[model samples]
Target: MKVALKIGYEGTHFSGSQIQPDKRTVEGELLKALLEIGVITDTETADLSSSGRTDAGVHSVSQVVTFLTDNPRMALPRILNSKLPRDVWAWAYAEVSDDFDPRRHAVRRKYRYVLNADEHDISKMRDAAKLFIGEHNFSNFAKKDKNNPRSTVRKVEKLDIRSQGPVIKIDIVANAYLWNMIRKIVSALTLVGNGTRDIEWIGKMLDPDNYEEGIEPAPAYGLIFLEVQYDPEPEWMIDNYAIKHTNDFYTRESNRFLVISTILEQFVMQPEKGQDLD
Candidate 1:
């Protein structure tokens, strides 16, 4: 059977999402678990695909993946969860078409950055987010590609600011992102919120032709892959039972994930040890 999976992970410990030699990585761990659980005989024949790539230290709540598998049984998510490590989870799965590719079918991607709101003005950040609501050139926000360059113009569907007790969550939805793009934009928005930079500075960065310098990217720990939206809603997503089942899975994870406690430990204890559930 061909299967699609909804995965969530704390990325603090992995080198990045991709598999590389001699590094702990999200994809590597996942494949290891799959092999051990008899999901596949070998990595080369699994035919795996992911919705997108996430940098090191970036978490995910609903990252998606698809793979061609011969396993005939259902409830793969629950089974995969059993074999995976504590920080990585497989929450939902459904049979999918052979042609469905998570990367190609996705229409939009959502990311959220959780920042310490105690030191910044939330009102100013709200105003600044409005400036990014349309298509703009973001070359200045990411690393320049000298060898194989892609277009810098991208569309922002929405940018929302939500405040909690001491944390401010900035949610950004876009067609896609360039390398370090969200971090750079968050760095700019934070400066505006902190009253260190004028709002016009954001407008200046939108100038299509010129790529500016010196805007530092935000810490990777604060960012997360929230979800992925598809062009035509997939059949698996329309199932009410799947929705309720995934919700139940999420609630179970919340009780055991200890997301907030892990972040606090990173802030208070030895972050260098990298055992804080990456």
Candidate 2:
């Protein structure tokens, strides 16, 4: 059976999702676990593939991977999680067709970028985001690939900017994306919010041929691969136990970060007291 699994991972420590020769990566660790569990003798027999590649420090809660397995029982989410690491795990899965390609079959992909609301004009960001709601040549906003060139034109089905407490959330849904597309868009929108750029600048950026300027992408840590939408969705088998296990790991990590933030806040409040000045 060819099986698809919904994967989630904290990519901070990972080189990236793809397999790299010497560095640690999400796919490398995943394939190792699969091999240890006797899922398949090796990767060649399984023909594993992912929905898309995420850059280092970028996280994902809805990433998907598909592979062939002779023993379906060994591929269960709970069974798979037994060998997978705490940072990367399989939470849900489905038996898919042999020819189903996760990347090509995906109908739409959604991404979320969270930015600190401090000093940003939320209203202006919303205005800037609306400009990206349709088809546009994103050459200026994306990193071009030399090996395999493709059209830079892509349709944005939805782009929403909203303030959520101390952070602003930028949610984007599109048919697909180019390298560094969403991150660069975030940087541009942020410039508008902070008064460095305006709505007209955004309009000009979309017309890549007429207006040319390089845009640096926002930090990858703030971006999240939220989900992928598909037509005639698979009959996914949700593993409540696996979900709870993953939740516990995230909750623990969150608490650890919260404690560190509190400690940093104390230093900010009493910088001189904590400092060792000679």
Best by TM-score: 2
- Candidate 2 has a TM-score of 0.95
Candidate 2: Cα lDDT at 226: 94
Writing each residue's lDDT as its tens digit, candidate 2 over 88-179 gives 88989899988889999999999999999998998998888999999999999999799989999999999999998989999999999999
Q: lDDT tens string, model 1, 122-208?
A: 888989889989998888888677897999888999999989987999999998888889999999999999999878888888774
TM-scores for all candidates: the values are: 0.84, 0.95
Candidate 1 overall Cα lDDT vs. reference?
A: 0.83
Question: Model 1: what TM-score?
Answer: 0.84
Question: Candidate 2, 65: how far from true, in Å?
Answer: 0.4
Candidate with top lDDT is 2
Score each candidate by Cα lDDT: 0.83, 0.91
Q: Residue 92: error of model 1 in Å? A: 0.9
For all predictions, the C-alpha RMSD in Å is 6.6, 2.3
